[model samples]
Structures are given as structure tokens and as C-alpha cells.
Target chain A: MFEAVYQYRDQLLHGLGMTLAVAIASFVIGFLIAAVLAPLAVYGGPFLRRAIMGYVALIRGLPELLVIFLIFYGGTVFMTKIAGRYIEVNALTAGIASLSIVAAAYLTEILRGALLSVAHGQWEGALSLGFRRPRAFLMIILPQMMLRALPGLGNQWLVVLKESALVSVVGLEELMRKSVVGAGATHQPLAFYLTAAALYIMVTGVSTLLLKAYEARLIPHMR
Target chain B: MSLDLFLPAFLAVKNGFLLTVAITIASFALGQILALPLALGLTSTRQAIRVPVSTYTFLIRGSPLLVQLFIIYYGLGQIELVRNSFLWPVLRSPVYCAILAIGLNSAAYAAELLAGGIRQLPTGQWEAGRALGLHRTALLLKIILPQAYRSVLPAIGNELVLVMKGSTLASAVTVLEMTGAARVFVARSYAPFETFLIAGTIYLVMGAVFGRIFRFIEIKVAIPGR
Candidate 1:
């Protein structure tokens, strides 16, 4: 078992790299979307808030795989029809897009929750200090919100990282797909998958540790 | 604009909805059964018991359920030992593999949630129980566990929603569940948008309904002052 995994070390590493890249890309894109949607969902006027709420609800309820298919297969078809030509949307792009969209929904919720946890008095206090609304939010509220949101953001990152495995169905050669391919080629499915599971466990384990440490560091300051 | 297509597409895939429900219920039931022992193990003081349970939860929670499904469906099936074992009959079916995979995944999550709830019981409660001369098992069963379940009901509902959504991954392993039905329809009709739109709507409805039920439970079961 060890020999089989050791022999495929390079392939596994490459797959790990791809998994991290896809996860990180999704996180960045999702954070950007969260930056827009979270505020709208939390404090926007009625119309904008309702629109964001609907999007979040739909995304939260649907399966990630179905969303991926809709974006990859459905998006491809729609684009090709519009362009009156074949438009290539690769598996990686599809994976990142779908994961980011889902992440954005969850992230919006997390951020909104964190923002709400910040007392209304804090905002009022900032306003009484003659700070404009945007400045008060950025200068007074954002830092505390980041501290509160960090753990949730970390969990969301882990979620995207794990969900990246689903991208394998689209034929992206990420960790899960590579493990499957290796298992098939080597005829040692257990060895390859155990290795894959172990790798995931390791990444997630280290992430939990790092997040805990980060939270610990921030705790004293919060007091 | 393509609203007319949704009815036939939905009709064709409605059975898949039942399959999805079956998978979710079976998996959730199995998870609930297994969670009790695992949750106990999690709250144990002995490193021997705690470490393994913690690691198991960590592992399952960390990885994608898709990989876990593939591992069981494809990975375990490859082993000569497994293929020849008494369990081979059960392992041969993709449905069993999907259930086992998702069930175990859900068990890990459920165990963690229950453990968290158990830990949150006021230490004073346990001390009060001891003062009353209650046996350990009686104390746990009558006092701690019941309150733990109440506290964790909302969290467990969240887990159920997850299991339901996760069951859609069974589509990958040749199970024609709701998502799988949509995949088949798209293959035949070449209508990716309409097929998935209907499927996505069904999932959204299931989630919305469950979300409301969980909220109602949380409010109904709230402790008077707390």
C-alpha cells in the first residue's frame, strides 16, 4: 500500500496543487461576491435586500453538483447559442465558478451574521463621533467584524476545498479525479483513495490548527 | 420564457424526488443510530476512546462526501478481501455503498454536534444529579442526554438538510435520484437549463420547508428563560 502511494507521489502532489488552486481561486472570487452581497443582504434598502435574499436561499438549498452542472453544461450551451459558435468552458472554470457562487451565498450569511453581532450602539457611537456612515463602517465596524468572521471564513474555505472534489465529475484532474484515475490505472483503489483521504485530512487538520491559533492571537486584543 | 418545458421535465423526474428522500431518510436514520456511541466516545475522558472518535469526525467532516462515496463504491470493491467477504453481498450494490458512505459521513457530523451539546450541560447539573445519589447511567439517560438532544435539535436539522443535498451526489454512482434523473433528461432532451432548473427548484423547496420546520422547533423548544 505504501509502495503504491509512494510511486504516485508526484501525481498526488500535482492533484493537491490543483485542489488548493481551485479552492483558493474560489475563495477569492467568493469573497468579492460576499463583499457586495453581504452588505446588500444585511443593510440595503428593501428591494436590493430581497433580491440578494432570494439568491442566497436558492443557492443554499440546491446541491453543489447540480449547480456545477448547470453552470458548466448549461452555461456552455447558453453561451454557444448566443455567440452562434462553439464556446469552450473548461472543467476548471466551471468548478471555480460554481464553487465561488455557492461560497458567496454562505459567506454573505456569515458576514451578515458577524455584522449583526456588532452592536448597533457601536455604529451609533461612531456616527456621534462625526464619522460618515461609510467611514464609520470601515473604520469602526469592519475590524471587529473581521475578527468575528474569521472562523466562519475558515470553515467556508474548508468547505470550498472539500467541494472541489466534486469538480472531478466534470473531468477536472483535481485530488479526487486523480485518485480515481490512479485507482483505475494501478488497480489499487483502496491505496489511492486512502491516500487521497489522508491528504484531505491533513490539509483540514492543519487548517483547524492554524485557525485556532489565529483566533487565540486575536482573543487577547478583543478583550 | 421556457416555463412550458418545466412540467414535462418535472414529471419525468418526480420519481427521482422519492429516491432522494429515500436516500436522505435511510442515511439520516443510520447516522442517528450510530451517533449515540460515537458521541459518547467523543465526550470520553480517556485518550484511547476520544482520539479515534475525534479523528474519525475530523476526517469525515474534512473531506468531500463525493470522495467518500467513490471510495466505498469503487475503492472498497477493488479489494479481494472485501469482494470475497460476507459483506460482499451488501457492498456489491451501489445503493448500499451510497447509503453507507453518506450514513457514515452524517454519523460523524451528528456525533460532533451531539458531543458539543452534551458538553454544554451545566456542570452543576451533573453535580446535582450526583448529590441526589443517581446512578451514572440513570443520570446520563434521564438528565444529560435528553437535554443534549433538545439543545442539538437545530444543529441536527442543519445536518439533515446537508444529508439531503449530499444525497444528490449519489447520481454520480449510477443511482438515478433526482439529480441523476435530471442528468438523464438532459442527455436525452439536450435541455440542460430546463432539466436542471426543475431539479434545482425541487431541492430549493425541500430546503425551504425543512428550514422553516427547524426554526419552529428551535422556538418551540426554547427553555423558558435561557
Candidate 2:
């Protein structure tokens, strides 16, 4: 297994690059989407809030693979229909979009939970200090939420990384898809998979430790 | 738009829908049973047990379920020993492999949740149990596990919903679950959009229904005060 992994080192490295790229790209996009959606879900009017909540529920409920599949195939068809011409949706594009949607749903919830964890009195305190609502939220509430949201966001990052593997089915040359190709070529399915699993473990386990240490450092200030 | 395919697609995928439900229920049940010991191991004082169990959970959690399924479904069968072993019959079928992979993955997650619940148990409760002349075994059985279960009920509910969604990946291994059925239809009709839209709706309904049930159970089983 180790020999096979070594022999396929270049291929595997390329796959790893793709996986990290997709994960990082989707995470940034998802974070922005969550930022907009979380505030709406938390503070919007009743009808708007319900609409956002329902969107979250639908995304959360469906499988990520299905979402990717639907987006890849359905998006192509929909776009083709709109233009009355073929519009090929690339595998990488579909994967990132679907993963972003899923990540956004979970991130929204995480942010909302963190926001709620900030004491109601803190918001009132800022308002009483002569700052307008937007300025108060930006200066006071946002910092505390970030502190509280760190641990959950760390876990969500791991989730997005792992979920990126599903994009392999869409023919995205991410780590898992590359591993599949390598396994088929080498007849070392076990080695390729175990190596993939190990890579995932290393990425997630190490990042989690770093995130936790960071969270620990921030804890005193939040307190 | 293939709106005409809607009823046929719905009817065609009925078996797949049932299979999905079966896999989810079976995996969740087995995972819950395995989770107890795993949770206990996680909360154990000994590093020998705790380290190994924690590593297992971490590895399982870090990796995607699709990879795990591929490992078990395709990778395991490639092993000469596995092919020669008594477990070959079970390992040969894609459905059985899906159950094992999904079950173990979920058990790892539930174990973490359960262990966290156990750890959060008040130290005063343990002291009270010890002060009441309860043995360690009796204390854990009567006092600890019950409270931990209550606290972890909602989390376990989340785990079930996760299992339901995760089970869709079994289609990659030819399990013919909802997603699998839709893929088959797409292959034949070349209508990915309509077929998947139907399958997605079914999954959405399943999730909503299960979510409501979990919420109901959580409210009904809420502790009197805490």
C-alpha cells in the first residue's frame, strides 16, 4: 500500500491540491453566503425569516451528493433551455456551487447560534452607549459572535473538506476521484482508499488541533 | 421538461425509496447499539482505550462516507484474506457493505455526542450516588446512563437525520436507493432534471417528517426543569 501510494505520489498530490482548492474556495463563498443569510434568518421580518429558514431546512435535509448531482445535470439542462443552446456545466463548477449551498446552510445555523449566545444585554448596552444599531452590531456583537463561532466553524470546515470528496462522482478530479482513477490503474483499490482516508484524517485532525488552540487563546478575552 | 415522466418516476422509485428507509433504520439501530460502548470507551480514564477509540472516531469523522463505503464495498473484497474468510458472504453484497459502512460512520458520530453528554453530567450526581452506597456499576447503570440519554436525545435525533441523508451515498456502490433509482432512470430516459427533482422532493419530505418526529420526541422527553 505504501509502495503504491509512493509510486502514485504525483497523481495523489495533484488530487490533494484540487481537494484543498475546492474546499477553500467553497468555504469562503459559503461564509459570505452564511453572513447574509444568518442575519436575515435571525433578524428579518416574520415572512422573510420563514423563507430563509425553509431554504435552510431544504438544503440541510437533502444529501450533498444529490445536490451536486442535481446541480451538475440540472444546471446544464436549465441553462441550455434558457439560452436555446447547449451550456455545459463543468464538474468543478457544479461541485463548488452545491457544496457552497450546503455549507452556507450549516454555517448560517452556526452563526445564528453564536449570535444568540451573545447576551441580549450586550446589544442593549451598545445601543445605550449612543451607537446606532448597525454600528453597534458591527463593533460590539460581531466580535463576540466570531469568538463564540470559532469552534463550530472549525468543525464546519472539516465537514466541508470531507464533503468535497463527493464531488468525485461528478468527475471532479479532487482527491477521491483521483484516488479512484489511481486504484483502477494500479489494481490497488485498498491502498488508494486507505491513503485517501489517511490524508483526510491528517488534514482534519491537525487543523482541529490548531483551531482548538486558537479558540482557547480567545476564550479569556471573550469571558 | 418531461412533466409527463413525474408519475412514472414516482412509481418507479418506490422500491428505491423503501430501500433507503430500510438502510437508514437498520444502520441507525445498529449504530446506536455500538455507540454505547464507544461512548463509554471515550469517557474511560485509561489512555489505552480512550486513545484508540478517539482515533477511530476522529478518522471516521474526518473522512467522507463515500470513501468509507468505497473502501468497504470495493477495497475490502479485493483483499485475498477477506475473500477467503467466513465473512465473504456478507461482504460480497453491496447492500450489506453499505449498512456496515454507514452504521460504523454514524456510530462514531453518535459516540462523540453520547460521550459529551456523559462528560457533562454533574459531578455532584456522581458524588451523591457514591454517598448512597451505590457500586460503580450500579451508579453508572441507574444514575449516569439515564441522565446522559436525556441530555443526548436531541443530538441523537440529529444523527438520525444525518444517517438518512448520508445513506444516499450507498447509491455509488449500486445499492439502488432513491438516488440510485433516479440515476437508473436518468441513464435510460436521459432526463436528469425531472427524475432528480422528484427524488429530491421525496428526500425533502422524508427529512421534514423525520425532523418533526424528532422535535416531538424531544419536547415530550424534556427533563422536568433542566
Candidate 3:
């Protein structure tokens, strides 16, 4: 098992790179999607808002594992049909896409919750101050909502990082998959897995400390 | 594939939901039980128990449940000593192992949530309970638990949804739950999206329904819904 880790040092590094890339990409895209959907949720009539809410609920409720699988398998199938040729959906990309959708759904709620928490009077107050519709959002609302959302977003980011493990089944060579590979090659499942756990701990531990610091600095200012 | 395959997928998601519910309720129950003591330990008027429980909560809260599940289900199961120690039957089955894992996981989180609510309660309530001649259990059950549970229902509800989502980790260990079923479907037809899309729909619907039920229950207990 140690040999597996040794033999695949470069590969493991690559896996970490891919994992980080996937996490960042999915996070950005997911936030964008959620941003688009959030306004729809808030401003649209009951029917439109309900439609968006339904989408959000389903995405958030389902497991990332299932989402990854669906995207990998379904993306390929659907893409092939539309284009009249097969298109391979790489495990890493599929995992990112699927997770992004799931995260976006969760984030829509996060944003909505934050949005609601911002008193309605602020909007009218801004408008009275001659802040136009768009200017009001940028100056008056967005900052506060973002402050409220920071902690929740931090938690969700951690979740996304860990959920990337599910991408292994789709054949992504990330940390979890590398651990599996190492375990298989060396027949030291326990050792490799434990090492994998340590690596995860290092990543998460560092991030947790950072997020806590960020929260401490931000929470007081926001209030 | 044939229609028969769909049955298992549906059955699997249903069973998965059942397992999901079972895990959430059991985990919350156990978590609250364990965490309260631990929280008390944290604020203890003692140090020995306080330190270890704090450490336990920190470690558990810090790690991902996927790793924890793998450790409990696969790592522990692989050990001959564990098998021989008389927990074999339960440890061997993925379901039991999942419950143990999830319960522990929730315990770590719920203890903190409960503790937060407990801390937020008016100190006068405790004093009032003390004046009423209530001992530990009666004070907790009568005054503390109800208020904490009420105050934290929304937060706790969020945790419940999280636990339900977390149960998908069980699919990795060969449990044929909802995600597991969708996985099987994808493995068979290589149509991950359709299978997962359908599966996701089921879960979303389940979550919505669960949310409504919890809301109803919350209303019944608190402001009493009309």
C-alpha cells in the first residue's frame, strides 16, 4: 500500500489538482446559477417562483452521488442524441456539473433566506434616496445579503469539497479514487484509506479555521 | 430495460426514504441524548468528561460523514477483533453500520445545536424550575427540552434535511437504497441522467412533504395552527 502511494505520487498530485479545479469551477457556476434563480424566486409570480422552488428543492434533496451519475450517464446519452454523435462526459466534468446544479439549488435558498432577512424597508429606503432599482441592489442590499450568506456558503463549500468524492464512481482520479486505487494496488485498503482520511482532514481542518476567522471578522461588521 | 427493474428503483428509493427517516429520527434521538450530556460536560461544573466529549464532538464535526461511514462500515467490519467482539451481526450489515455512522455524525452536530438552544434559554427558567422542586430529569424534560426543541426546530429541521441527504453515502457500501437504486439503473443502461433525474424528483418531493409535516408538527406544539 505504501508502494501504491509511492508509485502514484505524481498521479495523486494530479488528482488533487483536478479535485481543486472541480471544486472551484462548480462553486462559481453554482453560485451563478443560484443568482439567476434567486431573483426568479423572489420577483416572479407564484407560478414562476414555485417552478424555480421546485427545481431547487429537487436538486437539494437528492444525493450528489445520484446527481453525478445522472449527469455522467444522462449527459452523454442526451448530448449524443442531440448532436447525432456520442460525446463522452468525463467523470470529473460530470461530477462538477452535477454538483454545481445541486449546490445552486441549495444556494438559491441560502440567498433567499438572506434576502428575506434583509428588511423590506431597506428597498424602499434606498429608492427614496434616489438609488435606482439596480443601484439599490448593488449598494443597499447585496452587501448585507452577502454578509448573511458568508457562513452558510462556507459550510456549503466544505460540503462541495467532500461531495467531490462521489465523482470517483464516474472514474474521476481524485483523492477518493486515488485512495481506492492505492488500496487495490497494494492490497492495504486500511492503510491507504487512513492516509486518504488524513489528507482530507488536513484540507478540511485548514478550511474550517479559515472560515471561522472569516466569520468572526464578518459577523460583527455585518451586525 | 424491463419494467421489473423500475420496481427495485422505486422500492429502493422508498426503502431509502424509510432508512433516511429512521436514521434521522434515531440519530437525533441518540444525538440529543449523547450531546446534552456532552454539552453539560462542556459547561460542566467538572473537567474530565468535558474535555473528551468536546474532543469527540470536534473530531466528528470536522470530518466528512462519507469517510466516517467508510471507516465504520468497511474498516471496522474488516477487523477480526470487531467481528469476534459480539457486535458482528450488526456491524456486518450495511444498514446497521449506516445507522451507527449517521447517528454518531448527527450526535456530534445535534449536540452543538441543542447546546446553543440550551444556552440561549433564559437563566431564569432554570431558576424557576429549581424553585419548583424539579430535579435533573424533570427540569430537562419539563422546561429545558421543550423550549430548546421549539427554539431550534428550524435549525433542527435543516439538520434533518441534511441527514436525509447524507444517507446517500450508504449507497457506496452496497446498500440498495434510493441512490443505490439509481446507481444500479445507470450501471444497467448507462443513462445516469434519466435515472438520477427521476430519483432526484422523488427525493425533492419527499423533502417537501417532510418539510410540511414538520411545519405542521411545529405549529401543533408551538403557536397551534388553525
Candidate 4:
């Protein structure tokens, strides 16, 4: 029953590594994009703000799987057109791109809320203290916003982690895809899938614990 | 780029759109029914009941719904007992399996939402219910649940959209929901952009319609003064 897991241990470990890499890479990239977009959405001109909002709305409205498929297939066509030859978008690139796109939309909303929660007085005080506007925003306001955004950011991280599993639909050979392959080859679907589930649970469980500890350390007074 | 495929793609996805809607509604209804009891268990005073229920939600919430769907659809069939059991017929169908998997996953999140709502209710409501001589079940059904659900109505609406998005995964197991339909059409026509865009539009419309309906309900059910 468990022999298949041992036999495919290397593949499973590689899959797990890929899953983490995709999740973390997408999340960091998404957060950086959101950091820029959220502020623009909140403070930019009406046209700029509306454009950002539209992008967010579009992503939010569509299913993640559809987004992944569109990026995977459409991107190949797009790049092919650009290069004047067929250019295939690999599953890994598509997975990370699509996930990052989806994550950016959600993170923008979270960060926007956090940004709004920071009072105007903070900005005014920073300027009065002789700090430039951009410097004040980067130094004083951004840190407070991030602290307030930590809880929502933590939840989004978990969501991104789970969503990475969907990338397997395009044959990315992530944890889910690897498990499918193992199950098929070993003819032991239950054992392989159960192991996959256990591995997911372990990562998520550890993440939840770490997030909680970090949140506690940063926001001790809230408790 | 393929303007010609747009109308044909729409026609192709019509049945798939209906199927997507059906699965979303059915699974969401099933989740709500399961949620009430799970929510009660979560809020139970007894550790025995609460611990098990919490664990169930924890495990379900921790993993991906795709894995859960595969477990039910593919993993269970591997069991000799499950294969021979009366439940095999229902479990074997990908549609039913998708519904069961998504419903179970939705129930975990809904239960947590309800539990959060329940915990947020002031103890004054419970005291008032007790003063009126309402029993435990009666007090819960009448006084507590109504208000708790009301407070969490927005979150509940959001969950509906999430479940609808989740229904797209049913395609993976060969259930031709909208996404699956789009995939098939694109494969045949080699028009991925047009087909997927049409499918995506349908999803966007469905989400907007549901959002409006929930917003209307929220306004209608508002407690007059506070």
C-alpha cells in the first residue's frame, strides 16, 4: 500500500518543492505588484484608479482555472505572434504568471483597505517633519499599512498555496499532478492521493502556525 | 483575433453554462444544509463534539478542493469495499463526485463563517432568550441563528461566488461545465482566446447577477432600526 510512496519519493519531493516555489514566487511578485497598484488605486487620478479597479474586477470575476488556461494557451499564441514563430508557454511559466495575476487582484484589495485604514494625520505629520511626500509614504505610511495588512496577507498566502494545485490541470507536475501520476502508475489511487493530502495539510498547518506566531509578535497589543 | 469563433463558442457553451449553474446551486444548497449542524458542533460546549468538528473543517480547509474531488472521484474507487458498496453507483459519476467534493469543502468554510457569526453575537441575546423561557434548540433556531446569519450575509454571498468559481474544477474530471466546454471548443477550433473569453464573460455575468440578488436580500432582511 505504502510501497508506491517510497518508490516515488523523489518525484513527490520534487513536486512539493515545485509547489512551494510557485506559491512563494507568485505571492512575492503579486505582493509587489499590489503594493504599487493599491496605492495608485487609492490615490491616483480617477482614470488611473478606474483602470486599476477594472483590472481587479475582471480577475475577481473569472475563475482561477479559466485564468490559468487563458494564460497558458493564449500566451503561447501571443508570444508566437511576436516572434513570428510558434512559441510554447511552458506550464511552469503559465502557472506562475496566472497565479500571480489572480493574487495581485486579491492582494490589491487587501492592501487598499489597509492603506485606507492608515489615518491622513500620519502623512501630514511626516511632511511637517520635513520628509518628502514619497519618502514619507515609503517610510511611515507603508510600514503601518503593511502591519495592518498582515492578517489579510496571511490568509491570501494560504489561498495562493491551495490555488497552486490548480496549475496541475495544465500538467505542471506540481504536487497534485505528481500524485495523479503516481496513483496511475502504481494503481493505488487511494494511497498516493492520501499521501498528497497529508503533505498539503502539513505545509498548510505549519504555515498557519508560523503566521500566527509572527502576527502575535508584531501586533502584541491587539491580542 | 478570431472574431468568427465568438458566436459559435457562445452556442457551444450554452448547455455548459446551465450545467455550471446547476452544480453551483446544488452544491451550495448541500453545503448550507451540512453547515448548520457543523456550525452547531463547532460552537458546542462539549470538547468531544467540538474537537472532531474543528478537525474536519481544518483538514478540509487546509487542502485544495481539486485534491478532495480526486479523492472522492478516483481514490475511493480504488477501495474494494467502496467499489462493491451500494454507494458506488453515485460515487462513480464525475458530476455527483464533484458536487460531493465541492459541497464538503464549502461546508467547512460555511460552518466556520456561521461559527464566527455565532461567537460574535452578544451574550445579551442568549440571556434574553433564556428570560423568555426558550429551550436550547428553540433559542438557537429562533433567536441566535437568525441574527447570526444576518450579520454574516455578506460573507455568505462572497462564499456563493467562491463556490461558483470552484464549480469550474468539475471540468477536470470530464464534467463539461463551462470551462470544460471552452476547453473542448478551443481544442477543436484552435481558437483559445475567443472561446475562453466567451466562457469568462458568462462567469462574470453569473457572478454579477448573484451579487445583485444577495445585495437585494441583505437590504430586505435588515432589522429596521439597528
Best by lDDT: 4
Clashing residue pairs found in predicted model 4:
none
By DockQ: ranked, best first: 4, 1, 2, 3
Full-model lDDT, candidate 4: 0.94
Consecutive 10-residue window with the lowest summed lDDT within model 3 chain A:
A187-196
- Tens-digit per-residue lDDT, A154-206, candidate 2: 98999999999999988999899989998998889999999999898888889
Off by over 4 Å in 1: A219-223, B1-4, B212-226
The lDDT values for all models are 0.90, 0.90, 0.77, 0.94
The number of the candidate with the highest DockQ is: 4
DockQ of 4: 0.89
TM-score of each predicted structure versus truth: 0.95, 0.96, 0.87, 0.98
Docking class of 1: medium
lDDT of 3 by residue, B154-202 (tens): 7777777777777777778887777876677667766555566567877
Model 3, residue A61: displacement in angstroms? 2.4
Candidate 2, residues B51-114, lDDT tens digits: the string is: 9999899889988898899999889989999999999999999989999999999999999999
Interface root-mean-square deviation, candidate 1: 1.0
lDDT, candidate 4, B30-116, per-residue tens: 899999999999999999999999999999999999999999999999888998999999999999999999999999999999999
Clashes of each: 0, 0, 3, 0
Order the numbered candidates by lDDT, best leading: 4, 2, 1, 3
Per-residue lDDT tens digits of candidate 3, residues A61-128?
Answer: 77677677777887888788889998887887788888899889988899888888898999999999
